[model samples]
Target: MRNTLIGNGVIIQHGGADYYNANIIRRAINNVRSGCFPSHLYPKECADFVTALAKEHNAALNGDYDRYVFTTYDKASLKDFKSRYDRKHKHSPEEIGFEDYFLLFELIHNKLGVKNPERFEHSVVLRRMFLDSVFNQGKIETINERFSDGFVKWLENNDYIFTTNYDSNLDVVTRLPVHHLHGSFNTLSEIYDPNSFRNQLKDDLLDGEEVDLNYPHLYSTCLVSYVGDLKSFSMTQSSLANIGMKKFVKGYQDSPDIRNQIDEWDESNVLVKRLKEAIRLKSERPELQHSEQYPHKELNDISGALEIIGLSPNNDGHLFTQILENENITEIVFNYFSHQEEADAKRLFGSKNISTRDVREFWLDVDNK
Candidate 1:
């Protein structure tokens, strides 16, 4: 058995699931209807704006022309929104999101000759709404003790573990050097904290611009994007760093106090320091190093086979492509949720270096073995 790569489906299958994105949308709509902000930390202005937006959204959903503003609003932009959504998701805009609602508000507000669309454009209210919703809805108190213990032991035996999950369930269960491909909630917490080194640098750098102490989640996304871009640049000779830098600069451009935070972060951040060390190790020992930046690097570095648990290949084509192309990956054991998923995995990876088993059965076998 080779080192395994676990995905979000593993956590979900293990009873550590959270509310789906659809549920998030519904929760936000419900919150708006109730005239309440998801978090009590939000201001009255934000609450009122969101509530009003929700009323319009509800009306649109119900095709209530008298209540909805679609007819009088920017029809072109609304059509564009629908087209874009359909193209990206292969779904209709009728099933929109919190972000989409904000976009609609911007379109309608612009049409109504609202002089300052910035009120909706740069508002941190939507970001806060999402942060609060996910934080509240995705709380994982505990995992099955037997399963947790068994999984931890399995992780201990593995050479490396890579995950795309943002939750802290794995962190609570194991002390292994599990690389989080997607940003984690823990990272968000660090970025949001006023006392954190990153935030401290921001505070010192922004001259007199008042920091919104209540809405730290808004900045967390930006910081996460920055780190992700930095990591991508380090792994590949991509211009993602430049793009990320531009975003970082734009995010704090108004404040003159701290313009060098991004440049300074490389030297000051403990995580960045560790990442640099990992890069150095990779340079020194090509065979031994497992990259924290690129998931493909770790997959390619594996000397043995690869085991994929609770990941659908269809949703992760990039990762699947890497796995299929990497000659070092001698075999692949994929855990499937259903027959269709199993068939999809087989079709993607082929029968030569691949096998499939039910996720539940796979876990039970692993625990017993």
Candidate 2:
């Protein structure tokens, strides 16, 4: 029956029903706060405080974290938002975000504060992590089943699939291509592979600064560490309203734009170099441009009935703009779980005459009941 699910061509966007994912500001607190610094970082209390703080910023929004970022990004733009994040810690940006609230509440401020002489030139040591989970690979099967075999076959058959996910777990049954809009690992390995966090841990996080908490047991293994570590790869400062941030490893001078000052092995720098390498290899050979499958083109051309699973609109404004304004998209589907999410989707789609449906969840027995 799902073969009939789409009467037209469909474009898929991966949302939070993901292998390892977090959406709201409270749920994501543990990632940025990390066991790395907070010795006493536990769920019940931290969650209570974050949930309360999120409520204070916008009572109507409750604890919907995206509400903060979406408004901030809509005003400042991601690039400007990121470029000005260091300023958000001390002076407020034109638009405030969740990160600003953290500073406003004095939860994340350090000893140096805004007075550091080099603060003007230094950027936060942003991190991108893909946590390896024993449960990650198995979710692909559940996802495929929830999506339905008929639906999966259609995506595979037409080469119409694109994911923000950095993993190729869909290849278990897929033959064609699954475009990775965000970055992916340069190697061929399951995301659930043990080495993901283990390789990252060896990179060094110790700086001279004092940490909020210290738990040595968390450092002993990849499994425990993964639980207390960062999982998101793309929450940048631009969406953060210039909020203050913590660095992964300490010693640094000069901006990322300054190549001479950057360490060759720095993790954040490495992500930058990968993109540069990708561009450099593709740039010299103009002939390959024609043959290369540009993900942007796929996005620009996204038509038919659009099914948005769990894709967050925070960091991916460019892609959302294309689809949001695309006249060719006849219908839209939001696989949302709560009344809050359904209302959020309606607001997101505002004034679009095209029919949009909100289904509760893919895994639920009754999708829309």
**Candidate maximizing TM-score:** 1
Candidate 1 per-residue lDDT, tens place, 1-369, comes to 357878757656565434455656555555556765634445445545655665555444333333334442334334434443433233322255555566546544644556533563335556566556555544532443435456777777878777765556666677667666554555533334454333333233333434454444344432111122333443443234334434444444545445344334574775665434333333344333222333346666775667888677755444566567777777888889899899988898884488888988977866776
Residue 93 of model 1 has an lDDT of 27
Output the lDDT of residue 173, model 2. 51
Candidate 1, 208: how far from true, in Å? 7.1
Task: Put down candidate 2 lDDT per residue, 149-188, tens digits, no spaces.
Answer: 6545545544256655443445445666655554333222
Instruction: Find the 10 residues in a row with the least total lDDT in model 2.
Output: 222-231
* Per-candidate alpha-carbon RMSD to the true structure: 11.1, 13.5
Clashing pairs in 2: 15-310, 15-311, 16-310, 39-213, 39-214, 81-238, 82-238, 85-242
